[model samples]
Target chain A: MKHLYPIKESKQCELRKASPETIRFLLDYSKSLKIVSSRGLTFESNLN
Target chain B: MELHVDDASLVKNYLNGDEKALECLIARHNQRIFNFIYSKVFDTEITEDLFQETFIKVIRTLKLGKYNEEGKFLPWVMRIAHNLVMDHYRKNNRMPRYEGSEQFHVFAILEDDGVNAEKRLIRDQIESDLGVLVDRLPGEQREVVRMRMYQNMSFKEIAERTGVSINTALGRMRYALINLRKFIEENQIVLTD
Candidate 1:
C-alpha cells in the first residue's frame, strides 16, 4: 500500500541540494539510522 | 512475500522478541527523528545522543505495553524527539528562539547562485533540515513545495508535472507554505545569525 503511491515523481526526492555541513550531518545521521534500521531487515523466514 | 510487514508489524514483532523487527522500525523512522532533532538543536553530536535516547525511551515504552498504535508511529516518535530536545535545552538553560534572532532564507540560498562556498557549506545543514520538514508535507503538497522551492520551478512547470491547473497548483503551494510555517513555528524551528 505504501509503495502503491504513484512513485513516478518519487525520483525527485533523491535530488538533494546539500552543502558540506548538511552533507556531513546527513552522512552521520543516515549511517546510524541505517545501522539501527537494518536490524531485522534480513530476517529468517520462520522468525515471525 | 506474503509477510511484508509494516511499521506496526515490525513493532509487534519486536515486542515478541524479534529484535530485528525493532531494528526495522528504527531504520524506517530514525532519519525523520534525526531531522527533527538536528533542526531544533543544530548540533550533530547532541542530535545523535538525543536520537539514541529517544529510541531508548521508545523501547522502554514498548516493552511496558505503553505503545498504542493509532497508525501514526513516525510522528509520535518525532514528538518524542522534539520533547527530548526541548528537555535537554531546559536542563542546559538554552532554548531555541523562533525567527526573532534572524532568518536564514532557504529560498534565497537557492536563488542566488553566486553564494560563496563557505556560506553555502555553513547553511547546508539548516537547508537539509528544512528539506526534511518540507518532505514531511502530505503527498501533493510536498510535490508542489519541492518543485516550487527546492527545484526553483515556475508555477506553470509545477502544474504541468503535477497534472493540475495553474490555480490548483498555486493553491497547493499556498497551503504548503501555510502548513510549513505553522509546523516551523509550533516546532520552534529556529534560524541562526
Candidate 2:
C-alpha cells in the first residue's frame, strides 16, 4: 500500500512564503470583480 | 499600518470597501495556511494550487456576502483548505483513513447542510461575475450574450428581438464567448466549477 499522506521530517513552511505570482494573480482577479448588491448596484473591489 | 489589525477587523474592512484589507489578511495568514496545506499535500506546486483554490473560494464567499465571520477567520480558512485537500485526495484516489469524528465531523457539516446552499451561492456569484465580464464586450456582442445566456433566448428569438439575422446573432455569441475567454485567460480567472 502506498502512503497516502507522507510526512517529511525535514521540511517546514515559512511565514508569508506564498508565491508572489499567485498573490499577484489573486489581486488581479479580485480587482476585476465587482460585488453586486440586491438593489443592483455594483461595488468595485477598490484594491488600491 | 495593519500590523496590529485582527482578522475580524480586517474582514469587516474588506467587506465594507477596503480591498487592501483582504490583501493584508492573506499576507498575515499566508505562512500558517501555507504550512497547513503544504503539510497535507507535501508538494509545493500542489499546495500552491490548493492555496489559490482556497482563497478563490474565500473571495467568492466574501463577495457573495456569505461569510458570517464570528472572529473565526483563520479556522474558517483552515476548514476550507482541509476540504480542498480532501477533495484532492478523493480526486486522486488516495484518500487516507479518517482519524475520528472529532476530525471528520466537518465533512458532515459541509456535506449535509452546506453543499447545496453553497453551490447556489457560488452559482449566483459566478453569474454576477460573468455579467461584469459580459459588460466589457461591445454593445452588440453584449446584447447577444445577455439574450442567449441570461434570457435563455434562442438564436432566432435573439435575432428577432435585436433585428438581426440568426447567423449574425450566432456570430455575435461566438465572438462574445471568444472575448469572454480571452478576458478570463488574461486575468487568469477560474470561471467554472
Candidate 3:
C-alpha cells in the first residue's frame, strides 16, 4: 500500500525568512509593469 | 516625497483622466500588496503573476466605476486579489495550504554566502515538500489561511470580502489551523522553531 503523508509542518519558515528587500523589489517591478501596461506602452518602449 | 498624495486624490485623478496618477498609486501601494499576496501563495512566480493581475483588475474596475472610495483602497485592491486567488483554485481544482501553519521550512535567497551544493539541495527538498503540503488543504480553509497570512487582512475585512460573518471567518481559520496541526502531528514532521 502506498503510504499517505499528511502535509508536512515545516513550510512556515518561509514566512519568517522573507526579506523586506525582496518584497519591495517584487512590488516595484510589478508596479512598473502595471504602469507601462496601463499606458499601452510595449515592454520595449518602456525599457527605452 | 514632494507631495503627500492621498489615496482618494490619486484615485480621483486616475478616474478623471490623469493616468500618471495611477502610476503614483501603484508605486505607493505595490509593496504592501505584493507582500500580502506573497505571504499567502508562498511561490514567488505565482505571487508576481497575481500581483500584476490584481492591478489589472483594479484598473479595469476603476474604469468601470466599480470601486467605492469610501473604503480603504489598499484593502479594496487586496479583496480583488483574494477573489482572484479563489477563482484560480476553483479553475485549477486545487486547494491552497498555509505555509506557516505547517512544518517550519526556510528558503534562503542569499547572495554571496558561498554555500555549497549540499545546502542548495536541502533547500530544494524542503521547498518541494512544503509545496506538496500546501497543496493538500481543503479549499475553504486554504482561502482563510491565504487571506490571513498573505494579505494580512483583518477578520472583519475578510468577513466583508468573502461575505461571511466575522464569526464564520474566524471559525474557518480556527479549523484550518487545527487540521494543519493534526496533519503535522500525524506525519511526525519536525518544523524549525
Model number with the top TM-score:
2
lDDT (tens digit, per residue) of candidate 2 on A1-48: 246544663253333367999988787767667766766765646445
* Tens-place lDDT digits, model 2, residues B3-65: 699899999988887889989988998889998998888878889999999998898788778
Error of 2 at B178 (Å): 76
> How do the candidates rank by lDDT, highest first?
2, 1, 3
The model with the greater TM-score, 2 or 3, is: 2
Clashing pairs in 1: A37-B27, A40-B20
Q: What is the model-wide C-alpha lDDT for candidate 1?
A: 0.70
Model 2: CA > 4 A from native: A1-16, A37-48, B94-193
lDDT scores for all predictions? Answer: 0.70, 0.85, 0.70
Candidate 3: segments with Cα more than 4 A from true spot: A1-48, B94-193
For each candidate, report its DockQ versus the true two-chain complex: 0.02, 0.35, 0.03
TM-score of each: 0.39, 0.49, 0.40
Model 2 clashing residue pairs (backbone): none
TM-score per candidate for chain A alone: 0.32, 0.41, 0.37
lDDT per residue (tens digit) for residues B1-193 in model 3: 5149788888888778776777777777776777788777767777777877787677766765668865489888889888877776786666544344245533333256676787777777766655565557888878887899768999999999889999999999998888877877889876441
Judged by DockQ cut-offs, the docking class of candidate 3 is: incorrect
